[model samples]
Target: MALSLMLRNCPKLKGLSALSRGTFPVSRHQNFTQLVCKNRTALPLAVKCHNQFVKAIEPTRKMSADHSKLWSIEKLFSLILLGVVPATFICPNKILDNLFAVAVVMHFHWGLEACVVDYVRPIIVGPVLPKLALGLLYVVSATTLAALIYYNQHQIGIGQTFRKFWCISGTPADNEAKNQ
Candidate 1:
């Protein structure tokens, strides 16, 4: 009765009862059930087509080698960063700056390594490319850290450089004259 009153008050609600039953008077040329597939076909796919099927992974290989030790090392690096960042800003010690350079570089290398492993995977990029990429990464990281060490030893070091950037209050010419 309430529905009837609504239909009487609003003529647009006349077909609302039909909509509730999903009885829209519409038809398609092709049945959707035949068009859309629900499950994978059991036909002899690429793997099944071959004679020698892939073997199952060994049960003993559940965890990687030195997994716990590696995790602890990563955590140690993180702790060092937690201290080094603030100390670099506040005190700007040469030893701490060296530590900061090494620790920060190592942390960044590991993160970038994970990204390379995920994206430039052996399966997708082929075995040769992945190995080559990883080798290149190691070379670049080594040379970069070496250069950083050289800079820390010879120049004003990373912390002092950052401090100088903050200390400069006047124009570039004035700052240069002051340093000179």
Candidate 2:
């Protein structure tokens, strides 16, 4: 406690404290930290500019209501997915089939977006690549959803396709037997 008090009161002693780390007791580290913080040099211009850039681009959050609501919506999407997938497979209603295709495609798009956001982070893959990757993911997801909806609208339908997959016995003879 005496050494800590000395460190707080004397600026000259703070200089000597850096050289005596091996001899310094653990209790005095807090005082030493304050000395270092108080004596820090002005940051470089590049670092100062970076801080200003970050401040301008990303303001401090006040309450983040949008962030909280987004999390709840993600969970709600999950619950919808849980209901829509099995229901599509079990019963072959045309309306339910169309809903399943749209809902599941949306769910997959969100899931893939999360993966792209995580793996293609600007820090790791460079700033431009992450944005490009995200764009590409959006294109692919749009194409997939369009194709699924088109198939559901113009062909045998999504539900019947899934039913055929579920009921297939993996042999031409068995398929023919079932068809007849």
Q: Per-residue lDDT for 46-153 in model 1, tens only?
A: 233232222211112344566688768988999999999889878887798889889998998888887887789664678999888889889988988998888888
Candidate 2: global Cα-lDDT? 0.70
Worst 10 residues of 2 by lDDT: 17-26
Estimated TM-score per prediction? Answer: 0.60, 0.60
Q: Which 10 successive residues of model 1 have the least lDDT summed?
A: 51-60
